[model samples]
Target: MAKLGIPAAPPRGRRIQETITQLRQRILAGEWPVGSRIPTEPQLVEALGVGRNTVREAVRALAHAGVLECRQGSGTYVISTDELAPVVARRLTDDRMAEVIEVRRAFEVEAARLAARRRTPADLAALDDALAAREAAWRGGRVAEFVEADAALHTAVVAAAHNGMLAELYASIGAAMRRTVTQAMGGALTPDRHVDHARLVAAIRAGDPDLAAREAAAFLEPDPGA
Candidate 1:
């Protein structure tokens, strides 16, 4: 320690990180609407009272989080908030299981439609891999492992849609619901149920979203008392 010393260096990176977090929170809070242009780098520097590098770093961080899109010529803009919800709330809420089913219903319905239209040979292969993993889990009495594959199969449907926002939303919900679904199914996803998955793949191969959607919905329905 010096008897007389200069002030400490600013915590540039931490400040920038906090600024970015606040910006994302405001966007999710709807203070910044979807597709709206955020402040320019210079403007953010002024508004945040930070250095230019700080603002730029914050913007880059937000861009990487999928909340902001930065174009070369155009300024940054808010993308979507589907993935920005509180993960803790998702995990702790009792009603979330029902909410998951509802969201799954709407999302998978459209996902099936789009997947059937868009699924390629590679997508079919991914689906097959997930199903095979799930079948092996059932046979081995590994309920947790099977539930993960079930989640993956649903995620594969959204991924097959080739829509970034939908895929992100499905992934978030899948993470939140894995344990609940495993408990609900209770090690009872039988060979016949696995056959339903095979049929779903067939529907996608045939480019029939309606049938695929129906099969997906059937699998998600809550078991009695489950």
Candidate 2:
């Protein structure tokens, strides 16, 4: 029996997994936002109290999962927040925009219906802020800003549903949804394709689930211009 000595080290596989979780947590916590390079190898080793190899393995794992991107000369950068984003994007190719819209209809319509039933005052307040921001972004005519704002408002609706799984699933496929919206708008958003979500919001505010679901589904209908 050994005595007066340090405990045995954890298994190498478990250590590597723990390191990966720690790194992912940092990214999710916004310690290093997307496009920002992460701490260097030595810095991470010191910070995580792990060896150089362990830090390297963790970074490599995240890179494989599309959450981190390591350039040839520059440091590694945070690319995506959700681990499933890249996977979803890859599965939903560009040519499948119709399928993408169908997927959106499934999530958004249900989320809207449930939001009408379950949303709280705070959720309604957040939705109002997001909707206003989305409209302002559209009027500003900055395609990228508008895309993000629109996505934010839809995400707010999903959040209001108060179903953790639905919210998480929406977030998982969020990048793909934004990509389709961007493609549909092409280079710019013409007045002809303007989408007014005021009715959708009003239905939710009034606790009209059927109206909210109808409003959500209506927006996803075939619009040659939209």
Candidate 3:
């Protein structure tokens, strides 16, 4: 267990996050029985070699997401699988397009920010390929091909961020939104969309975070008229 009062430090937050993810996976994998008390923060901190704050954050997130429950002073408990499963399943397929879009907006905004900061030559190449495919599909009036390429382009922007969590979350919901976009905005890629996509790529390549973010948001925002 963790020695008390040690300010937990993480040499690498990604490793710490991975530890936390493993812990969560273990819990969900039935390693922790329902109503079973999981290790305390101090114990987890020591075991995982991460800061107490990291463990606390992970625990709090899980609790908030309904995977775990913490009593005021007692301890954290794994919730029943049936209960937790539904919550996780719902998270995976909630079907709330508005909520999903809100989440995507937040993610894409940060992705644009990171892309401006971290994009590499290879990232630019991948983005170029995706965009080129999208443009070709759009010009050919092949709606399905356009949809696939459009999804690839949007996801390429996320990948350009170089944030693993952001990329993963974006991929998860991007898959869902791919369907939605094909259904909703699959018609004409639109002059506005073409302009916005090109501008976003240019802003990212130019390392302009604000411009890229604005373009991404504009791309996603619904036309009040449409």
Candidate 4:
């Protein structure tokens, strides 16, 4: 990570907490856009006039919150600007998969309903493109590609809802959901899942909220027999 040099004064408060707040403000203010690397530890320490440990603690805090991501042998990069990202990131863990699934269902079900009512032609087009990519990947026996497209489709559906907060929440758990999807794909790739996706998209296109919600729920429902 390369530091742009501290552009502001140290925030007035507890050293570490203030440092964290200031860093977060910088990110939110677009000083560092998403995917942009943050300043290195030494640079941060120098800029903030804080100890090395203070800088480390602030970085760790932000990273855990999902605002910053540290890549081994590389540097930290901004993953998101959502203020809720850190909160959601902290709660999303392996042990909480069930809870995560429930939350995802809540968002997706409502998203489907809203999308049926609110989706524009552009939204439908994006959905179609994503579905086509997913189908092609499945046909090609490309698990990774299928997973990526599947994720993109779900994101498109949520985005079609046109709710900023809902979209942010969905984006917050994106990393976890992608990992889960990849792992599931390691098992058998069932044809019905793709069929379900097509059904959901069709319902949305038809502008049937009830049908769209039902299709979305059915797609998300875990197979009891599995």
Local distance difference test, each candidate: 0.70, 0.83, 0.70, 0.79
Query: Each candidate: how many clashes?
Result: 0, 0, 0, 1
Best-fitting candidate, measured by TM-score? 2
| Model 4 agreement with the true structure over 59-177: per-residue lDDT tens digits | 99888777787755447867678767767867788777666677778989999999999999999999999899888878887666777678778988987898866766776776667
Q: Please, what are the lDDT tens digits per residue for candidate 2 over residues 1-226? A: 4457967777888899999999989987878855446999999999999999988988998888878766544467666777565676567777777778888999999999999999999989989998999999899998888887888789889878987556655655566787888887887989987889999999999999999999999979866765
Off by over 4 Å in 3: 1-95, 186-195, 222-226
Residue 103 in model 2: shift from native, Å?
Answer: 0.5
Model 1 lowest lDDT segment of ten = 85-94
Candidate 2 Cα errors over 4 Å, as ranges: 1-19, 23-87, 223-226
Q: How far does residue 168 in candidate 1 sit from its true spot (Å)?
A: 1.4
In Å, residue 216's CA in model 1 sits off its true spot by 1.3
1-226 in candidate 1: lDDT tens per residue? 3336866645777888788877878877867655446888887878778889888888888766666666444467665565463342255355667766767788888888899999988988988887787677777766667776676677777778787666555545544466567657666775444434787777887899888888778777755776
Error of 2 at 20 (Å): 3.2
Q: What is the alpha-carbon lDDT for the whole of candidate 3?
A: 0.70
Better of 1 and 3 by TM-score: 1
Tell me the spans in candidate 4 whose CA falls farther than 4 Å from its real position.
1-65, 68-79, 188-195, 222-226
